[model samples]
Target: MVVSLKEAKLYLRIDSDEEDTLITSFILTAEEICEEILRFPLSEFEEVPKLVKQALLYCIANMYEKREGSYYYMKNEGGGMAETIGIMKIILGNLRKESW
Candidate 1:
């Protein structure tokens, strides 16, 4: 779903296990992820100046969602999590550029 970075982060924090499952289920492939974003439930937050749902979708498609609120270092079996974060950064950056 299209959401602000803050909203997405908050959603991730709520029941990481469940959210991860949702993210995993939503993304079977990169293309699927993009398609899913197009289907995202729109929100008022989407009106924000800088928000790239596509970037978030790409990241989610690539990696297994992390356990919410993890503090200590732990091994992420799905190594693609980092890639996802990178994608988010890029998406957010692109959004910022658009707003400018």
Candidate 2:
């Protein structure tokens, strides 16, 4: 996994192993989502960029934080999930490949 359990824990501000399993699940889910969005497997890249890793962290944190909720929204920004999606787009934009 590109985002280590330790990293995920730190990002999630988790200090105990109580939720290790749950955090690992979130990390896996985030990685899958990122790979789907990028249209490529993360394992295919030997040297993933820092931004890509950060994006994964953000995704994992978001998922972990919102697990209890039936629905999610960013009320402060008035953009809901668009802000997150936009950030992901910007992070992956340069790495996107065009098919002719």
Candidate 3:
């Protein structure tokens, strides 16, 4: 995993382990979304950029805080950050490798 559970928890300021599983899922989801946005799997990169990691934390935080509502990743139904699509278009897009 590019971002560890501990790291994600720290970013979310999560003090309890009760939601570890959920957080883990979020990490995985965020990783995949980020990869898609960058058009590259994280494993292919020799070194993951700090911005991409930070964006992962942003994604996790968004999901954890807004778990009550219906989450729309790409659509601006709720309205928030422009990169809400995955918190990747801006952050991860800059790092996009276009490996095709």
Backbone Cα, N, C clashes tallied per candidate: 0, 0, 0
- Poorly placed runs, candidate 2 (over 4 Å): 70-83
TM-score for each candidate, following the candidate numbering: 0.32, 0.80, 0.81
Q: Which candidate is the best by lDDT?
A: 3
Candidate 2 C-alpha error for residue 84, in Å: 3.1
What lDDT score goes with residue 47 in model 3? Answer: 89
lDDT of 1 by residue, 1-73 (tens): 3443344445445544445545545443433443333343233343633355456544553443443525432
**In candidate 3, what are the lDDT values of residues 55-92, reduced to their tens digit?**
88888788777765655743546534343654457666
Tens-place lDDT per residue, model 2, 1-100, is: 8999998898888899999999889888878777767878888898988988998988787777666644444443333345655777788888765621
Query: lDDT for model 1, on a 0 to 1 scale?
Result: 0.44
> What residue pairs clash in candidate 1, if any at all?
none
Give me the runs in candidate 3 sitting further than 4 Å from their true place: 70-83
Clashes of 1: 0
lDDT order, best first, reads: 3, 2, 1
Tell me the lDDT of candidate 2: 0.77
Write the number of the candidate with greater lDDT, choosing between 2 and 3: 3
